[model samples]
Target: MKKIFIITGEYSGDMHAGRVAEILKQKNPDIEIEGIGGENLKKARAKIYCDHSKMSGFGFSIKMALDHIALEKKVADYLLNSYKPDLVLLIDYGTFNLRVAKRLKGSGIKVFHYIPPQVWASRKWRIKGIKKYVDEVLCIFPFEIEMYQKEGINVHYCGHPLIKQLPEKADREQFFAKHGLDTTRPLVSIFPGSRTIELRFLANTFIKSAKQLQKKHPEIQFCISHAPNLSDDIFDKYINGTDFKVIKGENQALLSISDSLILASGTVALEAALYQIPMIIGYKGPWILYLAYLLVRCIKKVSLPNIITGEDIVPELIQAKFNTENICYETEKNLYNKEYRIGFIKALGMVKEKLSDKYSAEEVANEIIKAL
Candidate 1:
């Protein structure tokens, strides 16, 4: 039996890696897959080396950072001495996976990177590390191929996994009734973020923004696309007295029916574009961290829809600009301005077209099999 090792760090990365695992298994029944990932990969039947739930965070403290470094080293030692897999697949989670790549360097083990590090986003210097360590890179975006190839890295544009994963739209009336939402009013969805750190910084702001928008347009109904990993108390702390309905595990269905959305910048922005939902993207962090990020960020725009289209198709309010007033203004524009909303939605079609219709997971699996 052929053995393959995969590594991913966050929820989105785990989800993408799981799809690839499913495709790989279907193509070759004798293959054995193991990985350091989350529940999604576990469900796909990849033997878990380490559950990523304990591994995810942004800007870790001294002790946490040291612990993660130790953990990465432990996994690397295990893979090198015991597992000795035929192929190593590294998905996102740039910092840890890049270190793993370094450890496996020149071991004659094929290292295939799915959704490789966003070196183009920032830290362009990491491309050198990627080129030196990874054997091949499977990219999701069309433009990423040229960027990686320019640095002489072998790369393939596998389109986006979300293209296949986007769920069908639910019946509007039934969806509203089932969620106990107001059917008569225009609906606005809020996606604060999936991480606890993100919620800590932005959830109260989202609630305040929603309340402000509701006061102005009393006929507008507010709801939250809550992440399943987070506790209900996290949301209740901010929305206890508010009328916002928290919808769990139904992001696509909610996006399909929303009139507009107030969201944090992440993969959900791309999903909003896929659903053609008019939205305002917002992000906030500690002042010191925001300052440091602004200093290093190479791109002007943060939202995925805007980055994909290479234009500001949707409004982004980040750092100091991410206030309740700005959120309300943008949401109001998306909800009330027909021309603005229509134009934005039309631009999203071009963004969707750029993603193409290729089955990303299957294509990635084919590459892995050929490499093996």
Candidate 2:
């Protein structure tokens, strides 16, 4: 039986890979799955070598590492030599997977990447390394294909997998009732991000923004939704003085009812897009990382909503722009301007056009089976 190695990092990457693996299994059940992923992928029958708890990010300290980096390398080497997968389906974690790709290059195992690295962002030169290591790059955004093709590497646009999981209709009333929110008021959702580092940086920004927003529209309700991985204390500390509702595992539901969303750019921007919610994007990383962003000369736009739309459809309050006043100004503009809100809705329609009609999981699975 042909074996496939699935590699992923973090909860989101594992979730993305799990959906694809589910689709692939339906396409060809005979093929076996083996590699590193979270519980979601393991539940899908992919043998779990290691979860993302070990290889989280470059920011993770040496003491925090669950196992030595060499241990992960040894595991990859062992898998390559033993199962000899026909293909390695690499999800978003480029750090470790890229290393594995380099180590196993020319071994005859085709490397298929599900999520393209931020080549459009600073590391545009990384495409050379990616093309050298990866056999095929499957990207979620239409714009990324153009960026990669420009570099002489043609990438497949698989359409965003998030579209498949996006709810057709959100229970606005139920969500409000469950969260003890007043259904009558216009809601503004705040997503600082899933990481502690990000929450720490942007929490004050989000709070300051929301506080300023309250001055303009006292009736407008502010809600801060927490990612499943984070604790309430983190968000509570930030939103303390303000009358903000603390919610968990209800990002979609929060967006559904939101008149406008203020988020730290990344995956949440995409979520806002899927929900057709108008948003102001914000970000404040370390000074060095911010400098690196400029040094690398990434795409002019950082938010996914802006990137996918091929225009600055939503206002991005990043780095220097991530202030309470700026965020509130953008939030109020989107909330009160009928023309602006309508334009955002129109942009969302254009975005939906670029996505696949079929379920993402099913489509991803069929692609995996074809490779086998």
Best by lDDT: 1
Per-residue alpha-carbon lDDT of candidate 1 for residues 258-283, written as tens digits (9 for 90 to 100) = 88888989998998899888989999
Model 2 scores a C-alpha lDDT of: 0.78
TM-scores of the candidates are: 0.96, 0.90
| Candidate 1 segments exceeding 4 Å error | 57-59, 233-241
Model 1 scores worst on lDDT over the 10 consecutive residues at 234-243
**Residue-level lDDT tens digits of model 2 in 1-372:** 888888887778888878777767777788788777888898788888777666654355675454446855786678677878888888887767787888888889988888868777677788888989988888877667777787777477777778878766578888778878788888898888888788889988788878877887888888888887655775566557766877888777787778888888788788778778888888898888889779888678887767766787878877887788788788888889899889887886666676666565665566767676
**What lDDT is reached at residue 275 by model 1?**
86
Q: What stretches of model 2 exceed 4 Å from their correct place?
A: 57-68, 146-154, 231-243, 356-358
TM-score of 2: 0.90
lDDT of each: 0.87, 0.78
RMSD to native for every prediction?
1.4, 2.5
